[model samples]
Target: MLFQILLTLSIRFFLFDFVLFKSLRNHLKTKGYFFRKLLSCPFCQGFWSGLGVFLATHLIAYNLSFLLPMLSFGFVTAYLSMMTTAIFYPLIDKFEKNYSTL
Candidate 1:
């Protein structure tokens, strides 16, 4: 569980940070409504990434026979991840503001 959270968070931050760095960041975020909504929100990032990680792990490690239970647990995990991302988003913001080359 802990590992899942950390992995999700790390991947979230990487996408929310490094992947979007440089000119492509602003371009993609502004190009389409969908891209804007997806890229600009920490909650969205967290929820999708968190749920994806959970489901992927379940598929890889076990069978999908417990799909309903896994979905419920994954939803809870995603919620937790969403809150955690929101809480950490500002800290990352501060860091970027202080050090960003832009």
Candidate 2:
């Protein structure tokens, strides 16, 4: 379990950290108007939003697993990963809007 958790976190960090940073940097350069008006910092805001989405998805998966015996933890983890990626789209938009203004 520890190994799995570590592996999952490593993957998440590796995939997201640079992507998020770059995204913020790009948004700051290209879309300054939106971000400043929204009162959000792309790097900081994106990190927290991503973290929140990850945590919420995992919590939901874990809670549901209790009622669904056939749902393995691995399945939940995989689903969460996919879901996390999908959730990033809207966050990117928000980040762009928030950071561009600043």
Each candidate's lDDT (Cα)?
A: 0.72, 0.50
lDDT of 1 by residue, 1-102 (tens): 788878887887677666356467678887899889988766667777877887788754455666665666556656766787667768878887888786
On TM-score, the leading prediction is 1
Off by over 4 Å in 2: 2-10, 20-74, 100-102
What residue pairs clash in candidate 1, if any at all? none
By summed lDDT, the worst window of 10 consecutive residues in model 2 runs over 37-46
TM-score of predicted model 2?
Answer: 0.30
lDDT of 2 at 7: 56
**Each model's Cα RMSD:** 3.4, 12.9
Q: RMSD in Å for candidate 1, one decimal?
A: 3.4
Kindly state the number of residue pairs that clash in model 2.
Answer: 14
lDDT tens digits by residue: candidate 2, 1-102: 545544564555454444556666556656677654322333333344444444545544556544353244445555555555566757867777788766
